[model samples]
Target: MLADALGQVPYFSAREVEALVAAWNKPITLRRGEYLVQHGQVERNLYFVKSGLLRIYYPTETEEICVGFAYAPNVVCSFPSFVHGTPSEYCIQALRQSELLGISKNDFAALLELLPNIARFWREELEKVLVGRIDREIDLLLAEPERRLERLLRRSPHIFQLVPKKYIASYLRMTPETLSRLR
Candidate 1:
């Protein structure tokens, strides 16, 4: 199951992938509203989603803003915290009943040590995420809400059906009412 989840990245051989999967300490089950990692806490593990939804959000002085969303077969965590061992500035919360394969930082480092090819795959994944972030930022700056909504729909249709409108609006840097109006 884990192998299939990670199959999109071609650098991993079956044996190496299995070895990486085996490095995970355990599987964690989370219910709706449960936080896998709260803002300001050190991110200890990388969460490989087995099932369900996760919202990556952050709190402002007066509001909570949704930064992104992750579905099953996706990865959830504060990337900077995971990479730098700093406290996370983001929160990762399960949006529904969810199962995650939890790989600790130590184990992940060891896997990279043992199988260097895994490092290439990890880099590629991170690059993909970074590019997405950059694109989103550009869109937020240059596009109107309706244009943003259209672009989002083109890139990830059915996301509105899967994720709440408020969160989607927040991620797009628009008011929920504005998103609704645009729709």
Candidate 2:
């Protein structure tokens, strides 16, 4: 699974892949709805989802707003917090029972130092994530809620089956009733 995920990262050599495998520990499991990183806590490790799904969200005064999600075979972290060494403003939780492989931030940094290729791969991956965020932000700013939901479904139809309806509704910036009506 780790090798497959590494394949998604461009130009990762076999040795670099081996090094990453060595650095990441065995898979850890989280029960449904369990918090992986809570708001206001420092996220010390970056998780690679081996199975199941995780939601990244922030709590508003009225409710928890879903911001993003990590599906199987994808990396999940509170980016700003992880990069800056600060408490995360968002929480990461298991949307369902999940299996994850994790590498501590320190270990990841050491790996980057040891393998320059991995550093390049990391930069490219972060760039892609940034671009995706910008696109999502534009959608939020310009699209109607129903249009946003339609776009989301077009991009990730599997999300409807994998994630809870309420979270999906929040992620699309619509009420659950609105989501149901659209559906």
Q: Quick one: best TM-score, which candidate?
A: 1
Across residues 89-158, which tens digit of lDDT does each residue of candidate 1 receive?
9988988888888888898888878887888877788899989888788778865788888888988897
Position 131, candidate 1: lDDT: 90
Q: Candidate 1: where is the Cα deviation over 4 Å?
A: none
TM-score of decoy 2: 0.92
Model 2 agreement with the true structure over 1-183: per-residue lDDT tens digits: 988788666687789888998999857899998988889998889898999899999988889999999988888888889989899999999988999999999999999998999899888888988888887887798558888987788878888988889999999988999999999
Determine which window of 10 residues in candidate 1 has minimal summed lDDT: 3-12
- TM-score, per-candidate, Cα-based: 0.93, 0.92
